[model samples]
Target: MPTLAINNFNIFCATLGGFITLFGLVSYLFKEKYYLSEALISLIAGLIFSPHATNWIRPQEYALNDIEILDTITLYFTRLVLGVQLVLAGVQLPSKYLKKEWKSLSFLIGPGMTTMWIVTSLLVFALVPHISFLHALAVGACVTPTDPVLSNSIVKGKFADKNIPKELQKIIIAESGTNDGLGYPFLFLPLYLIQHIGHQGQGSDNSTRVAMGLWFGEMWAYTILLSIVYGAAVGWVAKKLLHWAEERKYVDRESFLVFAITLALFIVGTVGMIGSDDVLACFIAGNTFTWDDWFRLETMDDSFQPTIDMLLNVSVFIWFGAVAPWWLFAHSPVIPIWRLIVLGILVLLLRRLPIIFALHKKIHQIEEARQAVFVGFFGPIGVSAIFYLYVSHEFLNGITVDGEIREDAAYLKEVMEVVIWFLVICSVIVHGLCIPMAKLGFFIPRTLTTALDSLGRTGSDSSDDPQPAFQQAQAGESETTDAEDRLRRRPGWSRTGGDSLPTRVFRIGRSLMRSGTSSADANRAPGQAPLPVSSVPTIIDSGDGDGEGDASAKVDGKSDGSEVSTGGGGAAPSAPALGEDVISGRTIRFHDEQQQQRTEEAKVGQKV
Candidate 1:
């Protein structure tokens, strides 16, 4: 074998791997403290080490700077991430959730998405010079769908589990997953028209009519109908086969965890060959796969999906940062920097918020103004936008020669890419910071208290506990009580507070450090202490629940596969079945068989 040359490729791999490792180490801290998203972190990393900056990792150079190669890489890479995320979303959702929320979901993806497209197109038409409404619609379609990868950051974390209502979280995730696929029709319609219209008035009205016919006959029939059918078929089959294998004890923990992703990739590949919507197929397949809820319940607790999702999402965004067309933003005069900035702001503000806010009352999922605002404000233009941008570019390339656009259609490819990139950047930063800012909002009262205390104008203190009133109520208190307490403790409602600014900040920092330590303890192997069953995490508690017997029996399920009771009684108390525990209102299944296998292996090692 020839000796491997140590070039930028190896350096890039090493650097990328190292950065991923570093991020992985601090990811929890970043999420807990700063509320930063992984996409935002990875993008910044890629930017810092990219060719345009330090030149430490030249991904574009690795592709030899060929536009076709870069686009191909981006397209496939994004395809994999979006497909995986959509399926993951589909699988994790409560069974019958879509059916139950059909009306609300339909409204979001239908009327809501249309409004976004229209507003975005209007913005693009007004801001960018010499762009037609059709091309602007195409660009608008690219950024209309909320990115699943970015939305996951908002919906699935510890903060969301506490702050966002479960229904609202599900709605956000469902909308992002469904609309990404639905956005395809919006994009292809405009693209088909542009292709038919051709360069500088070369096409006639008859060809335009043909394009309209093709849009329905070809794109709709093939991309939508076939995709949905094929997806449902694949999902049902996979679910059946997996269930069969599991019943036979042929499927282990690894296979159980890996199966969904493999199925998602299979859907993506097969759907791509048929020229159907792979992302939509993956979503549909996932829904069909877990329609009965068996698979989802079985694998709910011990999932590898989030880890896989994070890795793929981080990789795609990093690649995006490296290969972004910074030059296009800088040098393109027709779509100048000022226009791009204005368009980004207008698109962000007007795209989905107005529509969603206006229709919040009609939408059954949205309960209140705050929830509606939260949902409306977080429709981030991220990975999905990048994926569609390249799709539009490739389609335009087929129509135009050598990646060149006609004089009249300046909005087709070049200007579209610029606008999409700026929006993605804006979205990544803005949406990523949203939760952090909300967290900051929660601390504003305390900050004021600190200011007053430091100035020695502090009033009489009430409670010695450092925990906020809202936090105390979250510890199994009634919702009404929690709401009342929060209102009473709201800024200017009371002066009964604690230490000065510096001391309060220091104590909060120390509390976080201790919480991390306790979390590690909570996750320790069975005999120590049982994890808490309440909505609030065990780590946040002052200490573990007061007994050892309760801890061991709850964690280590009975050897005979019987339910373990909580209290000794004439009639045994109702308890979760073997290998399952209810935590935070969800059934968390443990791998009892896997644990037994490891125990036996340990015994064998001891005997040897």
Candidate 2:
């Protein structure tokens, strides 16, 4: 081929690589079930077709140096993409939304920090024989925080139970939002100790105190405080500028691009100059900026989310795939394959068990409790692991003596890099595939019921009473009844009781309708006739007096096929017939059955 033709072909190949990456994301949007597998396949194809890997096709002995350029390019690109994501995240934070959900925020912080500490500490102890305790600690801290970007894609609103407390969802989002930044100090602490510990020789005791003080007291504490303060300051200023631009009708689209880039660079420079964690500072700044009223960033968020998502998908899955050191599994000083498996299993279990136990007490219900545990179990190590490994390599490089690095330093770098890559790739695949599939069978019916009950209680306290026994029975018997018949029948009353019945029945009927039942289903059951009772209506009035009836009276009223009887006195009513309350038990059971049927139908359809 002519030289000009060859250059054009190479450029075309590069373009094709980019197209493959974009295609992976597009495929995910249309058919999420095949997302991971398709991304992985496309990434492999892109790598094979890329000009950068042409040397590998010639059967020459492979060397790391040959691929170094590609790796470095991808690494820097990932950082740039991550930086932009952090800035966008900061600029879009609904601080008011988070503030109102402080309980959820608190829940996230408590569990996340605790899990990080516990998992890291345990891993340090478990991996002590193979690796230094301090090194293990560093790795543990690095891997502890769940990647918010990854989790956000998986555990979003659609995947999560609708009846779950909004606060809990907020907690998940905010924790994922903030914890990666928060975990940086932990990532640095052990590495700092490993580096400076030997230099403190004869005065080791004093040196130890100083290092500890700096790591925990100054480095951790000061960095966090400063990031928050500086981030908030920047955010406050950005908010004002946004408002001014809006009022002047000068808030051009390009302005956002300029603002994000400038803010990111400024935060990175300032944080680096001050010896603080730049990533954390950037995240804090982004969060702060997003908290404002005038920015109305939700609009920007909607527009930018897909682009950010695309960038992240490419940066994480394909770019990383193209540069991954696939040869490292055959190399030395890394733990043997069997040992890695044992360690991986231990890490997953150790991380999951603690979180499960912690959340069980706070959240009631067995299935929801199980799901919480499952989420904890699958907290895969991601970009944070790479960040830590990079930091370790830099630290090791800085401590070289006589212009020569220590022999172990090279091994350490390789091990850290390979291990992080292994973990990240594995996590993306495992969690990515599992999250979608797991949603199928992970129903928490009791938790959902409790949530609905709580919402009903808090949203309107006046309607707090349980369904009456007579109404419960009528609803049960009327399941086969026509839609109109069910609607016309007053709640807690059989259809025979005409419109002349008291207003309480109408109120109960309304509550049932609002409780996610169609007006059709709310009517009396087919072939079920209204009960004839002189005493029952009077009893219902007495029991429901002042709208604070006995618990049994309310339960009976709500149950299927139950009946209520009032004595002569104005006291509470007696329990209705057993069948009256039976329907109450059936409502939830029926809903669950319907859901299961739908799920099965979907599966069958997919198969076909």
Worst 10 residues of 1 by lDDT: 540-549
Q: Which ten residues in a row have the lowest lDDT in candidate 2?
A: 538-547
Tens-digit lDDT track of model 1 for 105-130: 98998899999998998998899888
Best by TM-score: 1
lDDT by residue (1-608, candidate 2, tens digit) is 65555454465456556665667446535334333433344346445643346432211112234544444445445455555556655555566655665554555566756676667566645753456666666667766766655655444433444434544444554556576677767766776676556432321232556667777877767777777777768767876787788688887776654676577778766776786666666666776676754454445534455455555555355445555666664454566666555666676667655765576555433247655775566455666566555656666666554676554455556656766666666666666676545544354654575567545544553344343333343433312223333544646653333433443355345544334232334454558654433222221212222222222222213322233333434333333332232344543332223333333333432222
Give residue 145's error in model 1 in angstroms: 0.8
